[model samples]
Target: MEKETDSSEMFIDPVCLMKVDSGNKNLMFTHQTRTYYFCAESCRKRFAGNPDKYLSNKSPKRKGLWGRYLDRLNKTTGGKSLNCH
Candidate 1:
């Protein structure tokens, strides 16, 4: 049988906020009477270990363009800041 790829059937992974297929029963966990789907086993394990961390009331902070650039720079330069003249 062929599986349908419907957006309505997609569930967000609580840990990473990635879209997960609801039909993928293997990468899912239940908590507080709600079933959470995951895109990977690592995300599922993280959520299962600390459900409250991902389910917290606080939303993720949005980083601006400069902030994103700095993050990428830091990652690529091994924490060494480079000044362009």
Candidate 2:
């Protein structure tokens, strides 16, 4: 469970919630302060089209309830994290 030391090995594709080999640097992107991997370029583009939607629906480990609440605030506050996390 301790994958912090090796993110690529533990990488998970947010769009599909599928495990992805960290070595697939060609199919990944970073947003905010997180890295996301995709099985295909199409997935990447879809995510980029509406990241917040995908992010808001993300796993709790990615953004706790409080963090998500803060995210909503950002939408109304000119897209800036409240730094509440």
Candidate 3:
């Protein structure tokens, strides 16, 4: 027997592990700090207009396991990893 997988599972963001909302997957990308989930391109645009306000919780200097991993990976991969940005 084969296991069934949901299509929604493919849209989940790996860093946040949250299902992408129905409409705006195309507007997705990881910025310097956090993983943003938008409902539309306009919403993402709005976010870009003042990213600092929305991304206050995602400081680049904030230290954690993920931060350390990104630092090491950045050095090894020459910053090729998408997650590093």
Candidate 4:
């Protein structure tokens, strides 16, 4: 039997960086002692195609509305701060 992995902890999908409940082992895959969860099959497939890309620590910043607004302000300053001025 597959050793039951801890399901209570939540983790972000390496592919999308979206939070996921790790307890749902049915929706997860393991690689190099790390667990990855997927909110969709497409995301899972994308991760499988090139796990290294998604697993990298240098993940692209998420393009949420707030992030975009902050990025615009930081574009000239080269900072990630939230200060608009």
Best-to-worst order by lDDT is 1, 2, 4, 3
Backbone clash pairs in model 2 (N, Cα, C under 3 Å; residues 3+ apart or in different chains), count:
0
Give the residue spans of candidate 4 off by over 4 A: 1-6, 57-71, 75-85
Model 2 misplaced stretches (Cα beyond 4 Å): 1-8, 59-85
Instruction: Flag clash pairs in model 1.
Output: none
Error of 4 at 28 (Å): 1.1
Model 2: per-residue lDDT, tens digit, 1-85?
5644465466667777677777677898889988888888888888888888777775566876678787888888888655676
Residues 1-85, candidate 4: write the lDDT tens digits: 7867665777888777788887765677777887688877788888888888766645466465567777788896687565668
Positional deviation of residue 45's Cα in model 3 after best superposition, in angstroms: 0.2
Error of 3 at 1 (Å): 20
lDDT agreement with native, every candidate: 0.85, 0.77, 0.60, 0.75
Per-residue lDDT tens digits for candidate 1, residues 1-85, read 7655563688889888878889888998999999999999999999999999888723457564568899999999999878687
Off by over 4 Å in 1: 1-8, 57-85
Per-residue error (Å), model 3, residue 47: 0.9
Total backbone clashes of model 4?
1
Task: For candidate 3, list the clashing residue pairs, or say none.
Answer: none
Q: In candidate 3, what are the lDDT values of residues 1-85, reduced to their tens digit? A: 7644443543543343345653454866567765566655666676677766655545667765678888998999898866644
| lDDT, residue 40, model 4 | 75
